[model samples]
Target: MKFNRRTFIKRLFIAAASIETFFLIKGSISKTHLEKDKKELFNAGKADSFEKNKPYPFLTGQFFLRRFDDGGFIAMSIKCTHLGCIVQSNIKTGGFNCPCHASQFNRFGEVLSSPATRPLDYFPITIKNGDILVDTSKPTKRKSFSKSQLTYV
Candidate 1:
């Protein structure tokens, strides 16, 4: 059982690889459990808190709450359609700008510039007991903005 330099290096490499593999598997298993335990619907907040025709960003939820002038609500995903980059809301421009690719989207989630051929994805909104809940589990993709997509009170 004499330990040579070559043997030590080989054993070290094997141990490192095993440790890496174990961490990878553990991370994936934990992620799966987290996904399973996550709630499908997110309680945004009281309906009154959102102003009309304004976009409220939910950074943690990865979506934006848009209240239309007609008292309609839309839960739009911040992810850009062009390359899945998180879009930044530009208050001055009244649109979203993707830092990764510069794709622009209007407040309605409509693509105002190129590179993003489709509009931003959105979640379904449900008003329950004066609270606005967004179904984050399922995100619907749209080619363009439509009046029917608005969830009115």
Candidate 2:
């Protein structure tokens, strides 16, 4: 076996290609496993942790957890109903403002202004041992807010 420059170059290229392929395959496998076990349950901390009349963003800014003055908790989806853009909370206006289309929604997920035909979406909330659990898997779309939409702890 004579050591040649051509042979050395070929072997080095093969080794580098093999290493790159291995890493690509490994990363894809890990990503598939993570996607398989994707969970939508979000812990909003204790039921009492929320402040009254204030909105708290949770689960990577996916939803807003608001504690009403009447001691009720509601999880409103941040996604705008019009174009699916994330809405920002406007405390001064007491509503949510969508930067994409200028759609406005009240604190209860009702449409305050248009371009948005329907109101904002909401997630179901459960109180277990004082811990607030929000189910992002189940989303409810409504035109108005009702007593059933609120979760009283």
Each candidate structure's TM-score, on Cα atoms with residue i matched to residue i, is 0.73, 0.72
The best candidate in terms of TM-score:
1
lDDT of 2 by residue, 24-79 (tens): 99999999988766657788899987888888987473899999989999999999
Residue pairs with backbone overlap in model 1 = none
Alpha carbon lDDT at 64, candidate 1: 93
lDDT of 1 at 142: 90
How far off is residue 66 in model 2, in Å?
A: 0.4
Model 2 misplacement above 4 A: 1-39, 59-61
The residue-by-residue lDDT of candidate 1 on 1-153, one tens digit each, is 899999999999999999999999999999999986675888999998888877899988789999888888999999999989899999987789999978899888988887999999999888899898888887899988888888876
